[model samples]
Target: MYIIQKLINRFFVKNKLGIFSFTFFIVIFSSVVMQILEPKTFPRWFDALWYVMTTVTTVGYGDFYPVTVAGRMYAIFIFLVGIGIAGLAIGKLVEAMGAHRKRKEEGRLTFKGKNHFVIIGWSEKAKYAINEITETHPNLEVVLIDRLPVTPITHQNVHYIQGDPSIESTLIQANIEEAQSVLVFSDDSIHDSALADGKTLLIVTSVERLTPHIHSTVEIKREEHIKNFRHAKVDEFVLSHETVSRMAVRSAFSKGITGIYTQLLSHKEGENLFEVQKKAEWRTYKDAFDGLLEQGATLIADGNDLSINKKLNEAIPEDARLYIICSKDVYEALA
Candidate 1:
């Protein structure tokens, strides 16, 4: 028993490929031997091959058999060898597939999807961001890249690639060039705020260097890092500490303001902010606002300018992008 276990470990566990190759060779050799030994039963090499395949897989059809004494003895030998080889081959195949899946779950596999969202770094905020995006945009793929060995989020549309997001090769593994957008989260585990922001800046710089036109949003702990990110042409910057502090201050003075902000930010329940392209029919802010209002959407802004108290009669430029507050269903309907 000990000797058998040792052989199994050596050939099946440690050398799976070698055992698979040996099994394949045995199958071919068995087919040829069966053809030569039992010419009467198996008139052609094709018939012998078919019989060998069925017998090895333990799916014997019983359509052919060895009639002569010598053929019968050879048949018994072939049966024993074929069954062992087939069992080992099947076991090894299953083991290999399981290992591959384990590697993938560990975020060691390369992602191949295009037009996907690439999220860099991991934190509670990053996890929430992934949940919101995946929940809101079910069809869009999201790839999470981090230096951690395990995936932070598991979703059908999400793929994990474990690596340093600042590395060019890591970005390539995530297929950053073909990605729709990227979000860089500051490393919260880093004790030093400066170091955390610096890491995020490095990732942002790397992403911009690879794809200048791709939209990118980054989180930074310090306001001083804003200029560095602006130089990188980051589309947006989420100043974590500053933004939360301001929100907290406002919520203290105005009760339920935070609730309103939460509803506007959440994509799951209440209406959320979304941007829609300008249309020809809406020539002015009033025109666009009325059109959106008709569809149950409230126009919030035009480009970076607020539309709340603006002159409605002012002509909206051709390139103006309209931002609106509406439910997901309403936004989809209007869009």
Candidate 2:
């Protein structure tokens, strides 16, 4: 035991990789030596060698045999030594595989896809956005990039690459070039929301610099930061605090009323709110409304102004965004 301990300490402690490599070589040598020596007694070199290769790889082809007494004794030793070598080879293989996965996750890898959403920054809000998007558009693939270990979620549709999203190279891993939209969230590590907003602004600016025409949304931790984000030209600003405050106030004043609206916007399985483009082919409001009805969609209203339902005689404004209430499946099919 003491001699084994000393050898292990000398091999593993002093030179870890050298020990692993040496162990591999020793296994190969033992198998080769066993096959060559055993073949002299068995009189089948090629068959014995094939058996050795299969046994060492755990393939167990079972075609070759060691019928002779000497060859059977050799087979016993080969099994013992071959097991050790197989284990070491598997361990090394697993380690290499893990390393490759880490590099791919850390944005040191790149791939391309069409109509993907590149999510920049990692936070609770970022996850919320991912959930929302996935619920609404299950087919839409999401690529998350941030400077932290991105743990996997239940949904395999989402891909995560850990790195600084503000960097151009990191964005490339998320395939920002082919991405249809970008969602920028503030880093939660920053002490202040304004600081987080500043980081988000920087990321947005960088993304805009990289992909000029891509539609991007920036989340604002504070409503006051919205104006500063305007200069960055973000397509949408999600005011986290404002939305929460509105929910709280609504719940305080009227019980269960806010819950209905919340459910519609929550991107859950039930009803969902979506903004559909008003097509010019449909000239009148009634025409568009009837078209949506035929497609199994309920016309909600124009923009956030939900009270005004387009009248039969009412002219459809060219600039108005049509709000439609439908299921995600319906939205995807109708859109």
Candidate 3:
């Protein structure tokens, strides 16, 4: 009952289109019912409906006419009510169509797909992430949600929807439920990192509320908030500042460290981390590493099970299930 009342309020009170539609339906119904009751005195019900339409439109096709006094009175009343209703209906229809077109033009439309990536926020990190994601998953579609306007990317795989990512409406627009994963990035302003973090947390909370099982990664600038974010159950957190500081320290200590790191980060020529399924036919770390080297890709580390067999290197286990660092060409060939 409450829902019905809410709907009535929305249709009759909130939107003029709904009111106009209701009026149009009433006019049509009354004209049909009246004609049916006095069909002998008047023409056919369809003929009467047509007469009402033409009368409202001022077309006045003389083919159908009313002979009885009662029919004429009814026709006069219909002409008056139908003309107003028809005019309002046409106006409302035009308005609704215009709004829909505007939303589409502004890239505020919803999309749904499985295995798609949902990107929340439009910072520089997001740009970098998109570049990396496209190289890795060329066929994967990316859905971006932000408050600002949606800009077109050179890559056809990226899609944009404009809205506050913290809002459920925006997440729905990006099809959060069907997405394989979501990457929430920081806002553009450099000084507003905490503010961005708060916004991101809200978005994370909202996503969890709607879909508790969704996989999500968030960017955190400060180490202090890591615990709080972890408590929120975020799947992954990328410490951008920490990574940059590590690179800076490495560069300071070694002459070619920056260049080597750049190559490692890139997918083209240097070592890039890739996750691949281990077949039952192939077992043991030594065998897998040797096979990957033969395939023109060097094995770095494993991703699945991080625990290492301590004999070779305490940091890296020989029996670990995940491996990192490989060339794109080699990874694709193996895949």
Top candidate when judged by lDDT against the true structure: 1
Per-prediction tally of clashes: 0, 1, 10
Give the per-residue lDDT digits (tens) of candidate 1, residues 1-335. 99999987887667988788888888889889888988989899989888888888899899987788877887788788878878888988998899998988898888888999999888888889988887778899999988777887778898989987888999999999999899998888897989988888888999999999899989889999899889989999899999999999999999989988898888765778999988889888899889999999999887778845567889888888779998888888877
Q: After superposition, how far is residue 287 of candidate 2 from its true place, in Å?
A: 0.7
In model 1, the worst 10-residue window by lDDT is 302-311
Which lDDT tens digits does candidate 2 get at residues 181-262?
9988767678788788888888899899888889998878998888877877778888877888898898889988786886
lDDT string for model 3 (1-335, tens) is 99999986777656886777777686678668668756874466777677666777678887666677776777777777767666666767788899986775466777867789988887777888899889867898988777776454546787788887778888888888888899888665756778767777888889877777888898887778888788888888888788799889988888788877777777765677777767554456656666677888666557644443432233333445556457777677888
Query: lDDT at 196 for candidate 3?
Result: 66
| lDDT computed for candidate 2 | 0.76
The total of clashing pairs for model 3 equals 10
Cα shift from native, residue 85, model 3 (Å): 22
After superposition, which runs of candidate 2 have C-alpha atoms over 4 Å from their true positions?
1-53, 56-61, 65-91, 104-108, 149-155, 250-255, 275-281, 294-296, 301-322, 328-335
lDDT of model 1 at position 104 = 84
The whole-model C-alpha lDDT of candidate 3 against the native structure comes to 0.74
Sort by lDDT, best first: what order?
1, 2, 3
Q: Where does candidate 1 stray beyond 4 Å?
A: 1-51, 59-74, 308-311
**What number of backbone clashes does candidate 2 have, counting pairs of residues 3 or more apart or in separate chains?**
1
